[model samples]
Target: MIVLSEESQRTSGKDAQNMNITAGKAVAESVRTTLGPKGMDKMLVDSGGSVVVTNDGVTILKEMDIDHPAANMIVEVSETQEDEVGDGTTSAVVVAGELLDQAEELLDQDIHATTLAQGYRQAAEKAKEILEEDAIEVTEDDRETLVEIAQTAMTGKGAENSKDLLADLVVDAVLAVKDEDGIDTENVSVEKVVGSSIDQSELVEGVIVDKERVDENMPYAVEDANVALFDGAIEVKETEIDAEVNVTDPDQLQQFLDQEEEQLREMVDHLVDIGADVVFVGDGIDDMAQHYLAQEGILAVRRAKSDDLKRLARATGGRVVSNLEDIESDDLGFAGSVAQKDVGGDERIFVEDVEEAKSVTLILRGGTEHVVDEIERAIDDSLGVVRTTLLDGQVLPGGGAPEAELALQLRDFADSVGGREQLAVEAFADALEVIPRTLAENAGLDPIDSLVDLRSRHDGGEFGAGLDAYTGDVIDMEAEGVVEPLRVKTQAIESATEAAVMILRIDDVIAAGDLKGGGSDDDGDEPAGGPGGAGGMGGMGGMGGMGGAM
Candidate 1:
């Protein structure tokens, strides 16, 4: 193994960590405005020239062509959020970014890097407690309210019917994937395939076929059929010599045709050997191939589209569609089957274990193709957000119950820790201010002393944290809760904390020249700013800064 000098190694590590912090914050900030009901919107065009306009965090992150490892890490946090909660990815990224930002500010004041890092960790712990302490009980009546909360997060981006549709779809997806473990809410699954337009969303007893019938004479239905969904073309190929043959005589041409017929018969035999009940071909079939299949009492449909094949595979849970192009081993996916039944008007239905089948087909309809396309996108975004929100353990009270409780707990926890660690812990407490600060800001309230007043009123045994002043009672939080998931409060705080720590660790900003001159030699320009520069690490472009230059 090659060994790096201690100084070189330290420099590399710091730069790597710094980049992660910087890129993460940039990605987080990009989606901040699209957070709540009052939040604005963003329209992004990806590198592929595809246009995406939405406030959804997952959509934003997914559409943004990001290459930085640090930025990708931030994306992963959103991914994890999507995977865990079915929503709140935007909030997580925003909070993480804000935490970094705040951390950077603390670092700039001659504070130790370690201290800021410790403070951030403590602050995060406190914030989590705050989230839990602030959680309000979710009641049956609030189910629609839960949906309203989800819709509020999704509105204005697209989906004119987001409130009604997202509520129903989100609930269905949640219930479908929800396990006995009290709703494994995070495992929201989505499958997308390009196919023909169908009617409004409905449960089909059998999978829908987007392929046109092979021929007018072919039977539209085959009862009690064992279906085989093939990814390969149901075509037979001419032998190289025969294909190139120049027929000088009619007799020679006849012989060549006979050989081709024999080859086609063999191909059909292969399908039979494999026990294919009803074969669905991915590409057009050759005349001879078709003739042989017909004679063999086999039902064959050709030119089946790829998307149709994928959807059918998922729906049937059968394996058969393997590579028809380039034939990579891993590209292979299974094709599922269902027993066939006659449906009038050129449509056919396949039912397999009627009682056991759980897959539902939502044949969404729209006035125009464009409307359908837009609606599909909206559904995808709603599904993504809902999935992320449900992934974690449970949502805390949205009306500020947990945050308030957490703030009190953190202060108590800090009081118990000893000496120097206590200072770091108290600083950590100060960091939690960013949460309520952000919530109030998004709620259209003054953020400055709002948190202070909230704490004051809550401590005084008042009915609620703050009075509306106009309402003369606790401010109504129903609308607030409905839009809470969309807020970037947690994200802002987290990002600031992260930024503060990253900047504080910067004792020096070394230039490329220093490293070439041999790591901190006596002749090296005195740490850029001198005296207060703090030795080798203190100089602008000094040993420490040089490490960062890369």
Candidate 2:
């Protein structure tokens, strides 16, 4: 048996639970103000003094460098929300913190951790049922509604002012890539360029290549283009292994050079023979080949990345050929036009108007790099929400509408499952109201008054009723065009409940003596026996168990 060191610290039972609950709550509080349309932005300054200013939940939490294990779990919840739906990250984190806060009260009332865990699991399942039952079905013909959904997700983001224009682009991009297999977001690429206003952002019917023509002498535009996608270089290949070619005679050396030149010419000839008016090569093109290609008036781009090549193939309806010898006219892809254009001091190739094109690009323009970056993030969230809505074929009202409805229903669910588990379920119902409450607080309204009014409206058979942060009134979110995909809300609920339960189940804390760091408490003090702190108690230090009863 290993001997216990005198410096080792242990805090078990109630002390451990309280510490974890406090840490989780503190983390929730940090992002609490950054909720809803009126939410405030956070400026994160790292040691290098590089600053990030945004209210995006995942971005803020990721930049915080959290040390407490319990708080980290809350961060993981936001990450999962972002990874799953790309929005509602703040809602998920806020809900999780509220769940822990509610659980702490139940724990103080002599409730067991296992009972709370079991009740939360049941409540989470019931939440899914309620959401599905209440979700509004959307079909392919509902373009206006889909645009509204996209606009809702983009509101309160950097691109909010351009929501109408950006929403159209997002919906069009999603619909273009939608297939029986589902929406392939990979098919939709967002390209950002600084110097233009946000309203100048537009969607390209085909892919935009950042690289320009390989040779200045090559044609800048090719109409009714037949494209060849070459996976290999258009140059003579070197021997796979080291070899010696002994040519003592000058004439023999000339013959060897002539053969190499001939091979390169044949490669270009093959592309021409296949009716390829434009060529996108995955590898380099020999200088002689470029010269020949330019002489033939064929446009060519060299050293295109693999992803670009695949996108080109999709946009042009062409197949990538590994060997030029196997190239055929039928193997070539077609585009209405391929042209090189100069933008922001850089040359960009535009492959547009392909028949039945499956890939597209959204070019985002802004006055500054920071504005463009935030615009991209905002558009990303909109794109993700639209994709999720199209894939699931269902959506719900936003602005805390679904959360309020779910809270009202879960309380009834709790009564039906009466027992020690009932309290946990009831606590979960109360926990969900945190969404509307926080929304109100962030909007500078009375949170308690907003929540009470929201519950009253929800109870009056108004399932879509939600707090209008701008007006500080409960209104129909659907009528206001505030909507989100069912998947986003469901994902937030599942991730938040699961994370809260996982943290609530902890009951013991044992820490190493030399640990000096732990998650910060409300006062910003490091908990005793934290990750790098000396042994002590309270805060996350009391919650961190050192290889014991995790």
The prediction achieving the highest lDDT against the true structure is: 2
Residue 41, candidate 1: Cα error in Å is 0.7
Tell me the tens digit of each residue's lDDT in model 1 across 251-359: 9999978877787677677666655546777877787787677666666777766755554554444445553333333332223334334333344434333222233
lDDT of each: 0.50, 0.84
Off by over 4 Å in 1: 1-27, 45-50, 61-76, 83-86, 125-157, 177-211, 214-226, 237-252, 262-278, 282-284, 290-314, 317-355, 358-393, 399-408, 418-445, 448-550
Per-model TM-score, in order, reads 0.61, 0.92
Q: What RMSD does model 2 have?
A: 4.7
Candidate 2 has a TM-score of: 0.92
